[model samples]
Target: MFEVLPHLAPDPILGLSAAYREDTNPNKIDLGVGVYKDEQGNTPILSSVAKAQKMLLETETSKTYITPQGNQGFIDGMLSLLLGKSSPVLLSDRVAAVQAPGGCGALRILSELLVRCNDNAKVWVSDPTWANHIPLIGSAGLKIEKYPYFDKATASIRFDAMMETLRQVEKGDVVLLHGCCHNPTGADLTNAQWDEVLEVAKEREFLPFIDVAYLGFGEGLDEDAYGLRLLIENLPEVIVAASCSKNFGLYRERVGLAAIITEDSKTRNIAQAQIQSIARGIYSMPPSYGGALVDIILADEALNNEWVSEVNDMRERMKTLRAMLVKNLHENGSPKDFSFVNDQKGMFSFLCITPEQVREVREKHSVYFVDSSRVNIAGINQQNVETLAKALVSVL
Candidate 1:
């Protein structure tokens, strides 16, 4: 019976990691994965997290399972941190949150809830969103539609085309929006464009499903969440899948949360109950470590400040790398203008290289990037930037 089980396709990003591992080339550079690496080429644990772990070790605590809804304080702190207390949704008692395994877990559970609730509901995602978005949501038996987003010509967001596509959306449609630092394509909507999106959502009565994986990496904590905050102000029911992987560097710990915004406490409670049920059928409960670490950091004033500053440092460092790459690429006699890369945000940038060029970089230059040219800018550290730049020049 087990043998009858069909073969499975490998995850694109994960597969890349596996392939990179087996490669014989010693000089191969891997920019395929989304993990952050410092200038020394290390994904170090932040000092704030170290302190949190130390405090946890000293304190007497039970290893018993946390609640299905997760640590109450984590939920509260995460909600407040992601969406401030004074935000319209929270102020109206319209928000409900539950801890999930990770952003992927949150997305899966949310997809199950939405599709199970209404099979007719359509989820619209950007044409070139995170590749996993399709399989995760589709596994819930819901079909996804594509909205115009990336404009290769300008290497920027086609806001006009995006708005036009969304204008036709009706009430009850689930539009999966990246909160900040859009994956695959670093191009994102501006604050003014977010306002326009909210206006359209309001007019069309569409529900907003926000995925915020790279919150602090884009602009800053409060700044990255600006679009999400605006959505809550306009929409009554919004679904959010927030990830601690990028911001807190907790990818391996699998930390994330799913939230819903509704009109009243009664509805919020009902939605929360459903979320818990869904979580139980899935992972039963989230891992305690990452969530606990985040909770400890957020709850402590000094530690929170330290974590914020560290994140800011990481953001700035990525910005510096982007500027350097753009500058160096332009000066290297390459005809292609890579200046657009500087204007992009977050850790990942679409190098705009074709599949052929991508393959050439990997084979000849030993530079690894996704076929779509989505490369993690963080992977190019100080030691390897020039090497990567020269390799990129060779490929281009």
Candidate 2:
């Protein structure tokens, strides 16, 4: 029976990480994975998260099994953070939330929910989305299609092409959008662009399913959530999958929320139950410690403020790195203009290099990035910025 299992290919990013670890090159640089790293190349836990954990240790006593939906406090806090407390979605009793393992888990459960609602529900994803999205959504038995998003020629969002494709969306189809800090390509839609998408969505009658994994990593807390908030405000139905991994630095803790907004309170209650049932069938319950930490931090005004500031600092640092890289590339005598790096927000940017160039960078220069030439801006530092820039030029 075991022999019937097929051999699986190693994950591209993780395989690159392993290769980097084995290389003895002194000047090797890794820009593959999407995790945040400090100037010293460390993924440090946030101070706010530490403080919240201490408080939980001192006061919290119950470790018993939580409900299928997990902690109500965690869900409520996440909902408030994603959509303001007084937003129409919340005020009208048309929204509900449930704690999930992480954004991936939330997305998976949401896929299940969509399939449950309508077995033939079709989901439209952006081209060049996160690599894992293919398997995650497909595994849930939903049909997946692509829409034009990033343009290699311009190194920016293909808004015109995107609108053209979305305009043809069949009614009742689901359109998956990146809430902020679009993975693999940091190009985000401006408010005016978002307005246009919303109009198209309204006209097409498709539901918006937003994955807000990098809420505070783009511009700011509320600022990064602009598209999502706008959707909930103007639309009667929406689905959101939010993660605390990047913003709260709780990657391993697996804390996230899955929220749904319906047209009425009765539908909200029914949807909430369906979500809970889906989660029960999947993982039964999400982890408790991370949820407790987030609940404590979000409940306290002081801690919440500090966390927001820390998130802002991280965001600013990535922006600075983007600028520094562009400068470094220019100083290194590159023939092509690479200023688009600065225009992109969040932790990633695509170099738009061919796979052969990517291999050259890795094999000859000891520099590692994905096959798609996507680099993590957070992985760059003042110490190695010039080196990375020079390596990129060498490959060119």
Candidate 3:
């Protein structure tokens, strides 16, 4: 029976990572996976996370299992991060939140819940979303629809088409929105576009399922969460699946949270209970270490400040790389205008390269971006931006 099991495709992003490991080239550049790397191309554990971990190791007294919803403090901290400190959305404690394994786990659990509640409910994701989103949501049994998002010709968001598509979505459908730094394609809705989207969502009566993975990696912590917060404030209820993998640099730790806005504490109590019930069977409870560290840092003023500063530093570095890369690519004399890269925010920029070019990049030059042409902006440093730009020009 085990031998007869069907073979499967590895996750495109994570799978490319294995191929990256096998490549042998001194100049090999890996801009495929969404992991963050500093100027030296090293993924470092943040000093704040390290410090919080040490404190947890010293003060945490039990091997006891955490609640099914994990640490409430962490959930609260995540809320404050997404919704500002003075947000009225938290009025009378009307939000329901749960700690999940990671962004993927939260998404999977939400898919299951969506199926459980409404089998016919459709989940509309942006065109060319995170590769895992398709399988992750589809496998849970629901209608998966693609909303018009990226415009290949312009190498940016087709907001007009997107808004038109979203306007037609039926009531009760789940509309997936990338809160910030949209995965795969970095093209996100502008502030005015967000207002238009919310208007459509309100009129159409569709739920906003926000995916916020690269918070600090985009504009800034608070800046990145602008859309989600605005939705929560203006809408009656909203859902969010947030990942600490990028901002907290806790990828292996797998810490994430799912939040649902509600009408009141009574409504929140009902929703919160359901979320825990769903989590009980999925993973029972989120891991203690990462969540606790997040809680500790958010609880402490000094540590939280340091973490914010470090996150800001990472954000600025990615922006600098984007500026430098776009400058070189424009100078590369390619027919394609690379100015779109500078406009894209967050860890990735969708290069819109074909599979053949992707192969040429991997074999001829050691530069590796995803087959869909999504490159991790964090992987670009001062030393390699020109090299990557030249490689891209050569292929073009």
**Highest TM-score against the true fold, candidate:** 2
| Residue-by-residue lDDT tens digits, candidate 1, 56-146 | 8888378999999887777888998899766656677777788888999999989988976798899999988999999989999888999
Using lDDT as the measure, what is the rank order of every candidate, best first?
2, 1, 3
Could you say which candidate leads in lDDT?
2
lDDT of 1 at 9: 74
What would the TM-scores of all predictions be? Answer: 0.97, 0.98, 0.97
Residue pairs with backbone atoms closer than 3 Å in model 1 (clashes): none
The clash count of every prediction, one per candidate, is 0, 0, 0
lDDT of 2 by residue, 345-392 (tens): 898999888899999999998999999889999999999999898999
lDDT of each: 0.88, 0.91, 0.88
Runs in model 3 with CA error above 4 Å?
none
RMSD per prediction, one decimal? 1.2, 0.9, 1.3
Lowest lDDT sum, 10 consecutive residues, model 2, at: 84-93
lDDT of 3 by residue, 49-89 (tens): 99999999999999799998889999999888888888998
